[model samples]
Target: MHKKDNNIDIANDRNENIPTERISTMFSFGMGDFIYEVFNGIFGAFFFLYWETEVKLDIWIVTLAYVIFAIWNSANDPLIGYLTDRPNRFWKKYGKRFPMVMIGTVPAILTLAAIFSPPFLDPVQGAWIYFAWILITTCSYELFFTLSSLNHYALYPEKFKTDRQRRRAGGIRMALALVGTAIGFIVPPLLIEYENRASYTNMVWIFVIFNLIFFLSLIPGHRESNYLKKRYMKEKEEQKEQISFWDSIRIVLRHKNFLVVILIFFLDSIIGVSLTASVQYVAKYVLEAEAETSIYILAGFILGALISLGPWLFFSEKINDNRRMLIIGVFLNTIFLLPFMFANDLFWLVIAAVLLGIGGGALRIGRNPVMADAIDEATLNSKRHLEGAFMGVYTFFNRFALIAQGIIFAVVHELTGFNANLPNQTELAKFGIRLHTALIPMILTLIGLIIFFRVYDLFPEKTAKIKQKLKELKL
Candidate 1:
């Protein structure tokens, strides 16, 4: 059964059941977030360079490890989403999400560190170390990331059962998160002086400390569940069956829009590569600013945070009606990105960064809440709570983009023979440095816009009507 989509007349909805204090939890996540994403950028963008230059890992091994992680991350993303969403037995003694959240942090931090490391001491020794960390860290990352977020976000209904209220809450939280990223993106530029990349331990420790704050601060107001126990007790009297894994997939596939949404997410992520990877690329080639990329990247996130913190509170988002917001946002962002190729001045770069920030802001503010509304639409009609399954499907779709970026980046570097530390390389290697940051990401974003417009409904009016009807059905 879908449960209640609009519990308006029930006198007490899930949102009302949530304790008033949970609202404060949102602020905790923002304090140092951009740092982790920035860290990821450094790790992802420069791990190859780091390995190539500092630790001197084999390119073949590095490339292979990238492939392994790409494939692994894709498969694991939704698998865990599915597991976490389902009513589970693990939540019993484990105290719902707390145990999962607790277990995940250990590996997440460790794996994050490992992702940048050499495999072992010698070529073979380094390879072994790298591979070991990769596998352990990957699992830890997925488990904790999914566990913590799923538990945290699952509170949306509990926080505000009304559609409009949910959107508002989501918007506020997301805005804070972006701002946190902004803070995260802004400060690190000063800490990291990449000419001394070999001795960036100070910068690394700084990030680790902030991330620890993010990790530890989460404990305060997060809600718990005897949810597993509740599920078991309820299911015994209700369906008396666990959803088969195959049944779960079948249910998601049956929802046409749900499947389409997954495609949209995958497409978004792919095109997103251009946007996400651009900071590092632009800094190197255009600004000749290496680690200082964090400054500009934070600038974009801050811009996005300010602009995006708007629209999430309404039951219906207007973007679907005109979609000028997304289309124009992305178009301007792309046009601005192209300028890096021709513009010689820093002013143009700043302007372009701001433009990309606008589009990026729209994306941040709009994407997830819309997905939630769409899933609600599906549930009210299909009469099944399909959130877990849809997330699973979407995670599966995202892997391709991840793999494509890795391969493309590797090829580009190999071809350019991009010197990580060019003491006195010619102007061409300098160009190679620039290409590392932007060339591919720009192309990816353009294609992403085309894909998003082609397949997605900007705002389905049906989303509103379904919630309305569910109010009548008490579902």
Candidate 2:
């Protein structure tokens, strides 16, 4: 029988005896971000561009695919969280999250490959074929993505066990994710020609190989310990009654703090996906640059982010306030993104990208700690461990970013008379791309930040109480 030790002071405890080991563990854990961001960077940055431009799929068909895909994508998060959040035979041996993470990862990568490898077909006559391919492959990717990534996210608050550790882990994670995202943006332009389907397929295969290598590396970080297994088993026994999935979701939804966090998460998701997806258009239509020139522009953005991270991490540690750090990041990102609309040359464009990255970096560094804090509060209120459930709902809202992006593009493109068939866009269409690239995302991010600032009340003092209570409950 596993006994819950109420006296374990996880909040203050530190592994001072083996500092090297602790750093290694945190680095390994952060490596998972590298894997996640590579796929996200590649997929988000190029998926729409590939289908609409390269595959010559109609913009309406693309948007329709996104809508249908979002339905399945959003639907699975809570279900996967609910189903996998229970104790099973694997709990004692393999640990709960590790197995789910493992199960979801490889298949997701394979499906991502499938998404880029649609059969050669005419865009006009074979529209449905492309639509079916996008729907099936993207939905399949989302299912595995939610399974692996949600559990991985749930693992954070569980494994880190304290605010200081979470902040440290978050900085490292964001740093690696930035590197992966840079590769996603930079590599494609270097390898892909706008007209070559084979180049896109080859790029994805390279990503597949890169993803698998990093996948193997992340296994060490995700390995569960005997202590974690025992603690999970004890928590399971204390659960007493398992609520229905809908009820569980309602409980999480009713938590005001968690809801606010997810709303902000939803908006940020929109900003991230839209900005990445619009990069190629901005480079080609707006800047009139070659395919490879996009790499230099992306390099500026990524470089700014990577360089600014250390300062942001230091500031986060100094303030010890995730909420404030996040707010500042949002404000800066919003302000900086406005320049994208006015930047005419490649130099000015790269400068805007850099400024955008500087602010965005802080937001990236601060979000996980803030989210973990919210989850801590929710768990204390619910009196059960449901990180998986919370992440499920959180991710569900996040997937709506795709839908939002799709709609924004569909409406804007149709109204502006943007033509995928044409080599050069009209001035109105160029303006539309700029709106999708910067203006819309900037407005959405600002709105989210305002709402988050006004409604969210989880300050340091309140979070300290939540952490103390969670520790007292041995959760």
Candidate 3:
């Protein structure tokens, strides 16, 4: 029998050595983001466009469906988090997160296909059907996504305990995430033509297959090491007193560092969703460009992000502070976004995409490491190791950004007198599209940067102290 160690391992206590196999495993795990990004890109960039343009649903109905879905999405996250974090016999056999992840894979794939495959009906009847399907599919998708992603993310701090390790792993992860974004945003434009249902359905199927492939690739990587398994088991044994679900909510809400992280992510989500949702509009209406033109713009963004990842990684390592790096990245991204409001041709748009991509690389790479630091601090402070709870609450607020995106688009289009029935929009409507694509995202990011600098207190020294405390607590 193995004896449980009360003292948790710290980076300083061990040699700075990672097994070669573990590195490979971690990189393979990064591919899982491909599935998530593809799905996210499709839903964020095209789902509303499809419903509003192809199916010709009223904007308010679409917004109302999303608002309801957002509520449901938020409520389910904490419940899943609370349940997953609790000690259970199943985790002893299959690991804590892998089972939930696997359980969600098939349903996530099926529902993704359903979202794009609503049956033929009149516009009014189809609107109700579309509304119902959106609610069902989005709620279902988020449920399993939360289950898998929360657990997958929870493992990061435990597995990569040192800053050096996190930077290496996180850099690769963000790179893969961008690749997924490319596949999600770039390829579909090539497959699906403007308002072509058959092509759209085909594209959906292709994404479904890709989702299955990448998510399945994560299984081997999702396995917990013997050391982690033992640590979790020990923590479970020692902490027999379970906190109530409401109490878990209260604790996470009260955490200043966690709140800062959520706020930044929340604002970022709004900006990201707005930009994505407006891409097709920008390509079609603003540039008066072909449907395929959006692919080039999105490709430019992805390529820039991929190319700049190395430099951002190095800069973050040099500064040794994720918060400052994020602030710098978001500020630069905001500057890049401004040019888009004035862009009328493909050349300038692609140029702006590249610059935005560079900023995005820094933002994406720094986000997780900082979030991991926050989770570590929360775990130590709470003394409960509730990664799921914290992630759940974080995800809950993040979904609100989706709700905001829907509302923003609906209101903007309505106010600007955008009619999907028209072959061409009025000048005001075109300006509204530009505003949604660039101006609004820039404004939101600026606000996020301000809050991060002023309110988020997880500086390098403070983070170091928190990690040191974790070591002292042996947690």
Model number with the top TM-score: 2
Runs with alpha carbons beyond 4 Å of true place in candidate 3:
1-21
How many pairs of residues in model 2 come into backbone collision?
Answer: 0
Evaluation by lDDT, superior candidate among 1 and 2: 2
Error of 2 at 426 (Å): 0.5
Candidate 3 TM-score over all chains jointly: 0.94
Tens-place lDDT digits, model 1, residues 317-347? 5544323344554555555555555545556
Give a tens-digit lDDT track for model 2, residues 91-140. 98789898888898999889998999999998989999889999889999
Candidate 2 regions off by >4 Å?
1-21
> Which tens-of-lDDT digit does each residue in 1-475 have in candidate 3?
2232212222325432222225666676677676778878888888888888887888899889989988888888888988888888666667777677778766877777778887767778667877888788888888877777777777677777778878888887897889889988988888888867667778898878767777767777667665666677888789768788999899898888889889888888887998898999988777777679999899889988989999899899999998888788778767788989887789988998999999888888788888998888888888878888888899889889988888889989999999887868999999999888888877887877787789887889988998878777777
Q: Largest lDDT belongs to which candidate? A: 2
Stretches > 4 Å off in candidate 1: 1-46, 58-60, 89-99, 117-139, 150-160, 195-198, 224-237, 271-278, 281-286, 304-336, 421-439, 458-460, 472-475
TM-score, every prediction: 0.78, 0.95, 0.94
Decide which is better by TM-score, 2 or 3: 2
Estimate the lDDT of model 1: 0.54
Ranking by lDDT: 2, 3, 1
lDDT (CA) for every model shown?
0.54, 0.85, 0.81
